[model samples]
Target: MAVAVKKLKSTSFHGHKEWFTEVNSIGQLHPNLIKLIGYCLEVENQFLVYEFMPKGSLENHLFKRGPQGPQSLSWEIRIKVAIGAARGLCFLHEAKPHAIYLDFKASNILLDAEFNAKISDYGPSKAAAARKYVATGRLTAKNDVYSFGVVLLELLSGRRAIDRKKICTEQILVNWAKPFLGDKKQLFRIMDKNLKGQYPQKGAYTVATLALKCLSTEAKFRPKMAEVLATLEQLVNPKMTHFVI
Candidate 1:
């Protein structure tokens, strides 16, 4: 019933034609992706009907204020959400020839009635798994992993990926939290205080370790999506007898 309607006419005729075609070809995405039920492409008008996410975007939940989104999320719920997002990314990375989600950010992740995460906004940049990174000349998967790492850090600290006030410089979340990630002795300072020391210390260590791995300066050192998913699974069910040794 919910529809996303947008103007079909781009600034130029060329732009409009390109977008019109692009939207049409982006076929069935993963279930974890916000379901695109259908679309209508008429002259000068384009509309996409998506399964409405009553809970709304993860951005509002994690970063915004007021009645729309709460100030904090429970550690359990946060880990669950992280797992769903990871599963979605894993599907993309392992798809035939591979699918890449270049824009993997809090804003792009949506939540359904049960607070389940679903990735959205599958644009051209995300369609190809082998796209070259502009700066490092690596594959796009690394860039997506970097973005996901930033989201993980945000979830852990209950802070934005880039916070001007809390950060001493322009280094952002990773730079600000790097010390805490490596030094478990100072872990308490970096974790979201809302948890009130309720999280399992072992699980916390696992998550912190994964966050550091994802933030590794060398892209090659970052764990694959499959590895990330396994770690998150362990965090949620620590008694499952799977240790990341």
Candidate 2:
């Protein structure tokens, strides 16, 4: 099996110590979370080895660019990846000490040969929140929920979280998509154009609503990872209605 090796430029960087701490904090393993094969801690450099995700990141597939042009992902595949990534986050949130994935983004989500999503580049939350987190001194699982909401928006619209390349409204996905998520008539306007009208309309609306719920400004309003996973499961399994976001 092929493996991906990550090279950290300097041992002096603060993140290097945190990386070790995060690796040690992990207790049990989940299928959706990328497995850390091993690590080398040298005075000059640090390296982390993980299972290679041949399909690469969800970010590349979501954003269209380069000479090859748009490599659109099917609706079915998008749901599959979203659910898988959610499962990984849910697992982390339910751990003994419980972990918070501070940096949850499309780029951190990886895919195997079969398009199975595996979350990578995870660590324990910093004592202080990052830019995405709402509370600086107190970090919580809800912060991850907010970031997940942003990613869900990316999946639905086929855009970046913050793309300076685009014109005003199009630059930031959350700002641009929030208005449309609640409006049934306008929801389809945000659907990934690459889908080409082939995805299920009802499922699209459901996912949009879920994304909106996840993005709620009040941390208390954001559903737990387990609830997030349950809502997402409803997309493919329409029978799921009890916890429909």
Off by over 4 Å in 2: 12-28, 64-67, 124-137, 238-245
Please list all clashing residue pairs in model 1, or write none if there are none. Answer: none
Error (Å) of candidate 2 at residue 231 is 0.8
Say which candidate scores most in TM-score.
2
lDDT for each candidate structure:
0.73, 0.81
User: Residue-wise lDDT of candidate 1 within 161-241, one digit each (tens)?
Assistant: 877776385348888888888776787777877666667667777788888898888889888989999989877674734
The deviation in Å at residue 198 for candidate 2 is 1.0
Clash number for each model: 0, 0
- Candidate 1's TM-score reads 0.82
Question: Root-mean-square deviation of each candidate, in angstroms?
Answer: 4.5, 4.5
Quote each prediction's TM-score.
0.82, 0.86
* Candidate 2: tens digits of C-alpha lDDT, residues 8-91: 778433555665656544623778988777677875767877888998999888885648888899988999999999999898
